[model samples]
Target: MKWKKLLAATLALGISAVVMAGCGSDKAASNGEKALVIGDTTFNSSNEEPDVNPHNAYAGWACIRYGIGETLIKYSDKMELQPWLATKWENVDEFTWKFTLRDDVTFSSGRKMDAAAVKQCLEHLIANNKRAAQDLKIAAIEANGQELIIKTTEPRPALLNYLGDPYGCIIDVDAGFEQGIVAGTGPYIATDIKTDDHLVLKKNEHYWGGTPKLDKITIRTITDGNTLSSALQSGEVQAAYGMAYESYPLFKNDKYNISQISTSRCFFGKMNFDPDSVCADPAVRQAIAMGIDKENFVAKLLDGNGFPANGVFPAGPAFGGDKVKAEKFDLDGAKKVLEAAGWVDTDGDGIREKNGKKLVIKWLTYPSRQELPLLAESAQATLKEIGMQVEINNTADNNQVVKDTKAWDVYAMANVQAPTGDPEYWFTVFATSNATKNQGKYRSARLDALENQLSREFDPAKRAQLALDMQQVVLDDHAFVFCSFLKMSMISKANVKNYTSHACDYYQVTADLDVE
Candidate 1:
């Protein structure tokens, strides 16, 4: 929480400076009006390439989505898998798949994209991309003419979905690793990068998708919400991504085109399950879950920008089934549950104590999403009414905070659980004993079995059933206190056309985008 005071002061100064600079600038209009400017707060990389490295998980999404890289497969607006760099693919056998590469595709460095290129990219991905390496479990990949034969260790029904992940972005193998800006086959190429400040991309006339409508694009990083809003309002930036929910009303006019797309991401709290942790008790976790007012948090705190989450996956039957619902907010019920579990307010103090220990919880959350810290504060007030003392640590570095298991009991975080449009992805990342992203170290045998079944089961109905069963298992254990599903919003000038939002939060600016 030490960084919060500094962050607030820094943000105030940054906002003031940006607002003054924006009010006096006419850069967007003066630059031939052909350049598209985007303002965003989610750029995590300071590298010159920004997110060109497929191995860097935090920067990979930005690289793939912003046309700096291309994946073999991509998801459609409807969340269906579609061909991108690879023209088409088919299952050769239970464990082997073959893909047909696009002959016309060429990297920015003029390297031809053939079956060999595809194989090299996949090989690099397997070595660097942790998620792809874990999910694919590929035994071998062979390039034969224009066909790529991929043999997995097991029958992976979601192979296409896994390849569609941003981490699976294909790059020019020769220049990708050694250069700052890797050569890609996408419509736009990174011409220049200024780390956290800005990125300049120029059109790739040789792009197989056809030349983009815009000649150039600039992505500027403005972390402060007020600065982003001001930049957009003053026409300093033509578009903005990840704007604060409270700033939506500022763009509710004809001049701006606001696109609100519901994503697979969910904001939730993870309870530490370490044996020595205070939240190790199942009743304590359940009590906290029962005390949270998810509906109110979404409606009031989020300004109805999101839906109350009931499980790891979102609402669709393809990923999240309809079996589970949001947990009811019951303060009295939570207090009774704690009392039955031997946590009682024996002394005059409001907080309950078990044995000689006070019922105090250390809560940790980040401020990047702009909603998590507020959610932490709200939960703190709500839990206190149930004789639980919650101490919140609002830090910018949650990854480091989670490492100290003894210092924190609950951690609020957000993730697109089913980014690949498959439930198995969520299970592998959160439910399994060896899950890399499972900071809480939650493990369940039943959930593991269900996840295994879900992975191989290709039948739609059967997969849905397995997904529902897995949700129930996690809900029963109270592994996560489900909060809300994110509805990401992007605001742009009215002239900016074809700027669509994807369910997975994958694609952003594409070849079809243009400014009137």
Candidate 2:
């Protein structure tokens, strides 16, 4: 079969490939011709809704709607807070915040969005335990006729960052249930949302912040990286979302035209910290960390879009800690640790033995992300060097791993950060929430205190210091051996320009994209 038809089938079936070509035909929009085309992997939030009304309910889902839904504040690329629906906001006291709303803004439904509207939106989130609702217990959300006042149980410096997320994006109280189309105060409006397919948007004519330059935008969720790269090359879509690193070489020569950002999606193989499991020993965990050659794994397994990680913070301004020194490749060291842990080869076979038990282990991973399976295979090979038998298991369904944690000795997966940069938000994966979290069920009281302190610390400098300290605590404890910080490679046709990505993973659609 021809590649185009093959690609069409794979795209329909969600399979990634390599080698792509096609010249896109320039088509004009129809009478209501204001739409933008965007490409992504998934659109439906965990809530499984095409669109929702209340902001903060769905992080990724909210972002798409929030752009149409205005927020109390906005954050620039430089991470500076700016006013949005709320003209200005200030701290009335350590526990109280006052926001003066902009009376001129109106929802697409022509309903006036005022202090009362903002109060209603915030109250809903506080009432429901939204994940991003970490800082500021939100003691109360009140509207003083014209101004909105919010009181917190304590002072929260990261409040602006949380509100800047899509969940904080405000929408029309009445148009909240409108699905398939996006409606809010953003510069653009979502007109159509197709499940596991595509999304279409147009500039908001009712936008109070002056009209956008482009008239329309469209976004499609194409799972195949090669197909997306081909779409970019073929001009089927102006830009493509996630690309596997192995495909990066195809566009390496083309410079100043195709734009790519070195993003941070850390990947690692997590262990089942079930106290009953052999991997529960920190010494065993460290040995496993030492056995895998991260530098080579990332260089060979990941191509070029990865960085070796020492801890959870992604090695940047947001992450700080006493450098625990990089994990070195030491086959002998791995052997030594295993020996110290009483893993010995008593039989003539090369595999280790401990009280008649073979050092056989199972590693679990999913195909949700393309890189995870390959990473797990490399781990299996690396562990074998120390007389340990390793098995590789790959499943498309993640619930299997969740339901059968005891069956898995090690599980490989990617942990994406929540909208709030706070480490506390991630405890659901580590805390004693039973096995309700992902990765290994590891817990530490020190980690708990550090996470709690960082959340409440309103001072930027102090908060950063605490975050660094928290990373060290995890490092010293060997919590899920840190691997590489994965980068998001965005391939786009030359015509697409000025596209931007947020700190949190979703792509924003607007008039910025144009077909030259």
Candidate 3:
């Protein structure tokens, strides 16, 4: 189950390659016009189109829809919010807010955009609790002709952050959200879509702002690392999607340039914390954490593509970066803890036991990530030395992992976390109230208090102190074993002059990239 080896073995170039070039045409009509083709790792969401309403989990859909849609606010790389569809916003009171909508915006379907349309769109996403609904605290929204007013249950200073989410981008309501082809106000319009294949988008010439440089852009889906690498080499696709850290070294050819981007995404292992689960014991969780040397795991197992994670948040925020002194590996210490916890086999059966119970647990993972299963294998070998019975179970689909919350003993996979850097999100994930709640029903009070303190205290000095204190609690509790912070890499042709990437591996096709 070594993913690095398996991926490298299954590597092969994909489908008949197709290339198109016309750099010399229409130079005078548009200032910096160029068409670029890109490849993504998985098929984009079909139903989660962002242009209609909102779907937070939409992958390429979020970004692409952002280009074709509009938002009241947009986020800069600095994490600052800037005006987009809204001209100005006013905080009428601690819980009341108002936004003056821009009068010039229009949807792709030739419908004029207004406050009512925007309000409706936000309401749709808020109604569907599974998507962008939970992230916000909106109590009510009403459109006063050209002005939009919002009321929240609490004074949310981070309200701007929610609006800046790519999912919060606005869409047209004239086109039924559930039945629309594509209705948005962004710079581009999706002209055609081939499920699990490619999305063809053409620049909206009648856009409020001047038309984009590129007349057309096509995003093709290529899940195989080798296929994407070949696509970039053959010029079938000018850019490859997110490349694995291990796969980056192989693409060191002079023909293509590599770019590193920053994102809030990090890969970590969440141990089952329910009392009914075998991983509930702090000793067992600590043993599992200490068993695998994360530093070596990153270097040898991950081919040096990531850094060992000391906390849930990747190094930088107030709450992350510094590793807890106690969480450091002490293999002898782990053996002692397990022994003291009665996890020793008295029956000489090769497995540890306590009160006639065998120490056995299942480690669950998915196939999308070519790393977790391999890590599981290595973990099994490491834990076996402690006389623990460990089994790696490759779970099918994310739903199966969710279902296991009610039936299985353990689960391990990539969990996409919000980037706000607030510990409350973690508390919500692990608190009892959140169990069977979005975070898999894992509950811990220590984790909750740490998160609560991090949320309201926005000052840098205070926030940093809280983050450090909370990180210590997280390490002690072992609700999750912080693993590694991934480094996002991408391969594009040398001539792909303006192609770029974000740390989270998302791309902004219009502003950040272009081609000569």
Candidate number achieving the greatest TM-score relative to the actual structure: 1
lDDT of 2 by residue, 1-516 (tens): 221332233342221111111224322344334333445543433223344344433533534532556567765543457787788888877777888888888765566778787777667656653454554468788887559888877776667666765666676554554443334677765555555555555566767877776665556656566676666555666665565666667766543144544444567666677876667877677778788878887888888667777766566665542244545678899899889989899986888887777877777766546677788878888889888788777765554554576777777767654444554444434442232354467777887777667757777788777766766666676666767777655665555565656555443554355555
After superposition, the stretches of candidate 1 with alpha carbons farther than 4 Å from their true spots are 1-33, 45-50, 178-180
Best by lDDT: 1
Error of 2 at 372 (Å): 2.7
TM-score of each: 0.91, 0.82, 0.82
Candidate 2: segments with Cα more than 4 A from true spot: 1-36, 42-62, 65-70, 134-136, 178-182, 213-215, 252-257, 262-264, 321-326, 345-361, 416-439, 502-507
The lDDT for every candidate, in the order shown, is: 0.78, 0.61, 0.62
What is candidate 2's TM-score against the reference? 0.82
Worst 10 residues of 2 by lDDT: 13-22
RMSD of each predicted structure: 6.5, 6.9, 7.9
lDDT value, candidate 3, whole model: 0.62
**Candidate 3 least-lDDT 10 residues:** 10-19
Ranking of all predicted structures according to lDDT, beginning with the best and ending with the worst: 1, 3, 2
